[model samples]
Target chain A: MSPTGNRADWADDEDFDDPSVLPPQEVITNKDGTKTVISYRYNDDNKKVKVTRRIKTTVVREHVNPQVAERRKWEKFGLEKGHAAGPSFDTTSVGENIIFRPSVNWKANAKEAEKEGGEKGSMKDQLKDKKVKCRICSGEHFTARCPFKDTMAPVEEGTAAAPGVEAEEDAGGLGAGKSSYVPPHMRKGGAGGGEKMGGRFEKDDLATLRVTNVSELAEENELRDLFERFGRVTRVFLARDRETQRAKGFAFISYADRGDAALACEKVDGFGYRHLILRVEFAKRTT
Target chain B: MRPILLSGHERSLTQIKFNSDGDLLFSVSKDKIVCAWWSANGERLGTYNGHQGAVWTVDVSPNTILLATGSADNTVRLWNVKTGECVKVWEFSTAVKRVSFSPDGNRLLAVTEKRMGFNGTIAVLDISYGENLSAQAAEPTLTIVCEESKATVAGWSFLSKYIIAGHEDGSVSQYDPKSGDQLENVQIHEFDSQITDIQFAPDRLSFITASKDKSAKLLSSRNLAILKTYISDTPLNTASVTPKKEFVILGGGQAAMDVTTTSARQGKFEARFYHKVFEDECGRVRGHFGPLNTIDVHPAGTAYASGGEDGYVRVHHFDKSYFDFMYEVEREQARK
Candidate 1:
């Protein structure tokens, strides 16, 4: 209740003239069983701020033994003597919520979850296929090991010998590489359609084939062996049951080249293995 | 599930126990004070402030009328659970490491540490629910002294038929409760790896022993037969068998001294859940910053509380998923 109505004279309005004086809080009950509270307070900057909060109260009734109900009324004693009701701030607090789901393959699940959140593991995986390119001669070797290291500077620092290398180095190094975001179409060398998302993995996906109708006893190494005849298989992932650890009758095989993947798909389709005919097709792009 | 944290202890927590009703939780710590809290909300009901030294262990009577605590003060003190007043104190030659109430609440046992010139002993005192709560027996009814190896933790078996004691040498012994004579002794864990904690199953027919050898074993209390073993990477500090759910919660981590040398993930300060029958690790709930020193399951198995070396007691109520988890065979059996 505000004191404005209780004031005896208009001169009492002097209290409101002060900038520090805050208006009385107002609370209104809504029809939907919620209460709206509006209050005024001075913030850290000495500016008047209005706060609004909606409060909803729900009653949860629990049945318990009468003895427990009686014990709940016991008085605080010893060190906590004379304390008020509810948990004290110093002695009790609610901690972060923990998702505790029990599963048979908890170890494997935990490792996978950790790998997703772990920076070191993901960073290693990201740089798994990254190569060391010589800055001077564009060879598959370190710049210090390049044959032209003694005579030539790094392509980025060189003057006129390698224009293509300079442009490539500029696009990779100084041209919107870090510190700022540049749209794909606006980046250097953007005329030929800039690099796509997923980086090197996009090329690997093009060389991946989805093999279905595989026998449940199929193993990753077995699939790798079957697919490696066409070309060097980069990865073979066989879906398996988490509990039984048995293959789920499908697998994905990625080759080093899309041509090898196409050849494998054409030859492996409808091929019999373990009394089941396998159906092979190019793995569809996922999202 | 959101865990409620109780921060009444300033130093590391030693033990925590839930009353038979599962409504009240009692926790003792190395800070010399015992705290009683409502298990549902983690509201501190009161504090037992008479212990002069760090309290090593605590147990509430089956009726929840008396709370007994063993402390480094070399005494076992019984307190009126509701009033938080010390009812009786029994002095011993060495520090008391563990205290437990019998199944019927008529007898109390205290495990005294082997220190100075005294050998470790498990003494049973006759508890009375007389008109005056302070009117407890002054002397123990029987004392079982361990001459070869010191007993670290002990508890009463089913129907109080036997007293099971876990020793410093990782051996478990069953003794006749009436005569205090050793009935049988068996090495349940690795030799010389001390047994840190022993908690009885809901039926008391079996018990779980946590040892410094990084393993917890469920042994039949009658014959000390190892029924199942749950192994972990870090040494275990405490283990408890949940009642309704066929799960056992094991808590441990790197020793508190070595905690500074390892990160929290490496420290393994999470509560691991193992299938009681299958002995497979089902899940883990991580929260504590330090080693978990003690764990107690709710009598009804709806919730569990853990005390950590970080000086906080966390009470977690089980979620629906905890109960819904079932192996394929179990699901198949349920379908039948």
Candidate 2:
């Protein structure tokens, strides 16, 4: 059967033959020609949790039969999810607003649940056995004078808190993040960091960089020969245009050591390429 | 590979949960449907429909067939996993932000985000009485209220001993559900602006915190001490640590990593690919709008999935370097 109560095409041969086990839907019929509706449900295992059927039937409403006409109107009114009129069953006598068909629920009481969970169950379960609670906080264990709040370190003069810990930053106060550039914006923020140079990168450190261009240093053969002279050039970049693949103007060269970088910069700085002086320099330091 | 998109679009997807037992995937969407998919293979098993507004978050119980979803309609709907039907609905006032089931499935932690200029508190719902097909199992269930300013994030540990909560005050409090006493409550990580995510590490006592401070902080869940710090060039958008190794974190932001393009021969265009999401290869990638947004390393740590503002969550599996494999292959070719 389909999840939405429809049968799947692949499950064509699957049969739900036993109507005796079907969960029923509630229905109401009046003295006149109208009917009410109700619903029921079950899992794949076919255990019916609710049982009421709205098996529709119709009655005749005529000019002579005024009582039947009024009953039909009431029945139709009950068909609505919440209607004021319905059949003659006294709901007040039932003692409950709704009634449910019963099933086997294993844990009927705290005692039963507690038994299922032996002595070593969990701290939450253990505390409930005894009615001991923190009178001040009115909570489980720790009180208003919780020991952690009162750490052993002696107080200092000019700090809201002791060293190494500042205070919590209220995130909800900051409000939701809004940026036009990105629609779905969710960021990860650090907590409990009191240090001034905190966050991710410190003030002395750099945070952003951009590659302006990537151009060829030489023709393929000559470039190969020059790079082979070094211990090993794992990566070489001849920057190119984003739309067009032609060289942009410069590239990055990675070598095994700083010595290789210095050698390449010294030797290839002014080397003639297509009779044009190639520009080469050690990459500048970043923030 | 094409991911199986939910039937309805336009509505945003709020949260995703995996039922490891059946390897089924459950997703709550704004469309008000809880979709279940086979985890081992992507097959749409069922669609659970209920709730008036967007279904915001979905969580799975450990070993049982229970699925809970919170919606913007201000209600929590619990579903019987085997059947695509809602078994119960837990009502709330404001919108429910996060919903977590205790590891034992006997307790359901529903954290309703309180929004006001200067107030925050959480409402706890006990699931011991809220189990199975029997309404006859109604015992005295109580709603515990913990007074605070604002809770930005909330969850229960896998063990369910404590309710881990993050407040707008930049503080994290672990409270006992039964007694409602605040056990270990402190500002785990403080940021200049906001905390984007607070995660409990699998080991329990240790956890990771990410923030707009352009950094991620790892701390001890017991005392909430700073364990190690990971700095990013740009503010981190999303951060998640792997299940095995705590150090291996999967994250993506606008960190502009070093860009390098191979030489384009006479006519060949250089494949100038920008590094969007990367670990510390050479140096950390830096900047938002510079590279990546969402990233998830595989549980095995050998591969990863990254989704960026660029609009794709790509899966990358690491392969041994072909150059290393070909070293001997080249010698054999020379022998011939």
The C-alpha RMSD in Å for every predicted model, in order, reads: 15.2, 34.3
Query: Considering every candidate listed, which one attains the maximal DockQ?
Result: 1
Tens digit of per-residue lDDT, candidate 2, span B121-177: 455655543555434223214344546445656666546667777665556677777
Q: Candidate 1, TM-score vs. the true structure? A: 0.69
For candidate 1, write residues A158-272 as lDDT tens digits. Answer: 3233445435655674454765766546666553432432334467668889888999998888888898999999777776655788876777788989999999999999999
lDDT of each: 0.88, 0.48
Once fitted onto the true fold, the runs of candidate 1 whose alpha carbons sit more than 4 angstroms away are: A1-58, A112-126, A131-287, B258-264
- Considering the two chains of model 2, state its CAPRI-style docking category: incorrect
lDDT of 2 by residue, A67-134 (tens): 32332332211112242432222211111111111112311442465567576468786666785454
- Extract clashing residue pairs from model 1: none
